[model samples]
Structure formats: structure tokens, C-alpha cells
Target: MTEPIRISRTGSVETWTINRPESGNAITGKDVIAAFEAAAEGANADIAVRAVILTGEGKIFSAGGNVKEMADRQGMFGLDPIEQRWAYVDGIQRIPRALGRLEVPIIAAVNGAAVGAGCDLAMMCDIRIASERASFAESFVALGLIPGDGGSWFLQRAIGYERAAEMTFTGDRIDAPTALAWGLVSRVVPHDELVSTATELAERIAQNPSHSLRMAKRLLLESRTGTLESTLAMAAAMQPLAHADAEHQQRIARWRSS
Candidate 1:
């Protein structure tokens, strides 16, 4: 069987593509855990990989979780359930947290529809770049499910509580331009240029000192919940470590000589 996720590397960037195009890249139960593990391992292992780009094959970025699989599990476990639901939630949470925890940057290249968990998947990335064809929706409410992934956490953070509440409650789809206007996406390009534009952005990030980028990502992620004074203290502690790195010294010397 083919891998549900395809991973490729170019210089300091790793691109992860959701491979189930026929089903609009819908993730299966197994795919969710596997993809998360793979991404986390990649981030941990490769010091050279400074950024990650997430995209999907063919038309749709993702249609979210496999509806058929959900139906099948529902049939097996019955209607009123708890254990199975929690298991599914656990799997969903793992993927997004893994993506968010990665020290390097993550950029989502949304080529088409990113519905339900798919939308959360993109939101989990540090930056999102969408194609003109892209559309987003929380979608879980329509399916009689809550956002099982880190959707609740990230959505509120991304667009604020009111907007996130509105989207989650109504389950209405938002177009690329609307997403950009709402600050949900960094940029929107023509469908044809989506991949190229994301690659260019990733390449730019890749050119920076990898250690500095990782440390900066760490600080930004940590700052979300901490007090300003605490965050400042954290930064103060990190600055000397960054300055002491050989990469930082070399760059500083080059700047001085120039």
C-alpha cells in the first residue's frame, strides 16, 4: 500500500504532502498518527531542515477526516459512545501538537478545500499561504462533532474568540480572500503559483541561521500563554545562548568585515 503521507527534502526545507487525493486528501485514523509521528521525527532528527511546508496532492488540500471511516467506527461502537470518541480525540490532538512543537517553522500551502480537521491542520502551521482556489471551514459542527484537534486552541489564537466562535458555530466556508482579510492566512496566490510561492517563502526562511530560527520559534510558541515579564526573562536567557553559537559569531564577523 502507498504511504498516506509523502515526505521530501530540498536543502533546508522538508515538504510533507497528504497523498490521498482521490478522497480529497482525507486523513484516515492510521494516517493521522503516522503523519504526526513522521513529522515530529523529521523535526527532531534533521538540524539541516530549517522549515517544513505542508500541502496536499491533486485538487483538494484535504476534506478532513475520512467520513466513511467515522461511519464505520460508529457502526461498530454504537451511537452513544465515549471511549472511541476519546481515542479519536487523542489521535487528532497528537498531530497538531507535534506540528506546533516543532522547533523549525511550518508553512501550510493550501491548494484547495481545507475543511474540518483539514482546516485545523493548516491553522496549526506557523504560517499559512493559500491558493485562490482554497476554501476553509471548521466543518465539525455540521458533522455533529467538535473540533477534536488543536482547532479550539489555535483558532481562538489565530482569529480571536469571537471569530473562532462564529466559524465553529455556523460551519460556514470562507474563501481565500476572506481568510487573508481575517488574518487566518498570510498570503493567497493563484492556484498555479501556490506551491511556488510557498516554496519561495520556505527557501527564504531556510537561508537564515537554523539555530536562531529554531530558538525564535521556541520563544514565540512559549510567549502565547506567559506574562510579558516572564517572556522577557525567557528572551533574556536565550539571547546569550544565541549569541554564543558558532553560527551567530560567524555571521556577526562577516557583517563587521563587510
Candidate 2:
């Protein structure tokens, strides 16, 4: 079988493309899920890999799950409900867990329709840039399912509770402009420019000191669930470490000489 994911490097930035356009980049299968988990781990272990861009092949960023398999009670939705629950715990949920632990920043370049779990995947990234052709939906309800992959948590955080609820309840897709207005994506570009735009953004981020970037990302994650006092305390702890990093020390030395 062909590789489900394609990871390529351009300077300090890596672009991770979902290569299974034939399946609409259905990602709930074991192979795709493991591919994602492995990609996250590889990036986490490599400090030289400064940034990442996530996108998909063909017209859809991803369709989220294998609908045929879901209907057939195969793959991700296989066996009994009890077994399927474990399947979810040991399968698709790993994507978020791995992504949450990623030290470097991630950007999603949404080239087209991002529906169901697909939209949630984009939300997993630290930043999102959508193509003018791009769209998003929390469309589990339309399929008679809920976002079995933690879309509930990520969606609300991206666009707030009310809007997230509206999308979730309606399972309606919002186009790129509306997504931007609602703050789902940072910006929208023409279809042909999505990759270049995302790469430029990733490259800009990669130019920063890697350790500082990781620390800043960590603090942002902490802020989501932490109280202001707790967030401040964490930042205080990380600030010293950032200041003492060799990269920072080198910059200070160079500044002194100049």
C-alpha cells in the first residue's frame, strides 16, 4: 500500500500532506492515525525541525472518517460498541494527544472542504490559514454521529461556545470568509497560494529561536485550561529558561559586541 502521509522538508519547515485523496483523506483508520501519531513524535524529537504545515491532497483537506467503514462496522467502528469504545481510545484520540504534546508550532493550510473530523484536525494545529475555496463544518450530526474525535473541545475553543454550538448543532459548513470572520482561520488566500502562504508563515516562525518557540507554544496551551494566576506562574518558570537558553545567550553576547 502507498504511504498515507507525505512529509517533506523545505528549509526549516516541514509540510505534512494527507496523501489519500482517493479516500478523501479519511483518517480514522489505523494506518492514517498511526501515521499522524508518528509524524507528531518525529517532529517533537527533532529540534532542528522548526515548524510544520498540515494540508491535504486533492479537493478536500480530509473527510474525517471512513463513512463506508462506519456503515459496514469495519475499521474504526468495528466490532461491538464496547470494543469500538476501546478502538476510539486507542485510535483516533491518539492524534489529539500526540498533537497536544508537540513542542513546535503547527499550521494547517486548508485547501478545500474540511468537514467532520477533518475540521477538527485543522483545529489541532496552532494556526490555520484557509484557501478561498476552503470551508469547515462540525458535521457529525448530519451523519447521525457526534464528533467522536474531540471536536467538541477544539471547535468551541477556536470559535467560542455559542458559534461552536451553532455549527455542531447544525452540522453546517462555513466558507473561508465566514471562518475568518468567526476567527476559525487567521487568513484566507486564493487556492493556488495556499501552500506558498502557509510555507511563508511557517518559515517566518522557523526563523525564531526553536526553544523559545516551543516554550511560547507550551504557555499558550497552558493558558487555555489554567487560571490567570496559574498561567502567570507557568510563564514565570519558563521565562528564566528561555532567557538562559544558549540561543538567547548567544544573542546577548552578539548584542554586547555590537
On lDDT, the leading prediction is 2
Residues 1-258, candidate 1: write the lDDT tens digits. Answer: 667888889988889899888778986456646776787787768888999899999999989888876777653234456766766656666787677668899899999999998999888889999999999999999989888777889898999999999999999999999999999998999999988999999999999988889989989999999989989999999999999989989988999999
lDDT of candidate 2 over 106-209, digit per residue (tens): 99999999989999999999999999999999999998889988999999999999999999999998999999999999999999999999999999999889
In TM-score terms, candidate 2 sits at 0.97
Q: Per-residue lDDT for 63 in model 2?
A: 92
* Candidate 2 least-lDDT 10 residues: 70-79
Runs in model 2 with CA error above 4 Å? none
Pairs clashing within candidate 1: none
- Report the alpha-carbon TM-score of model 1 versus the true structure: 0.94
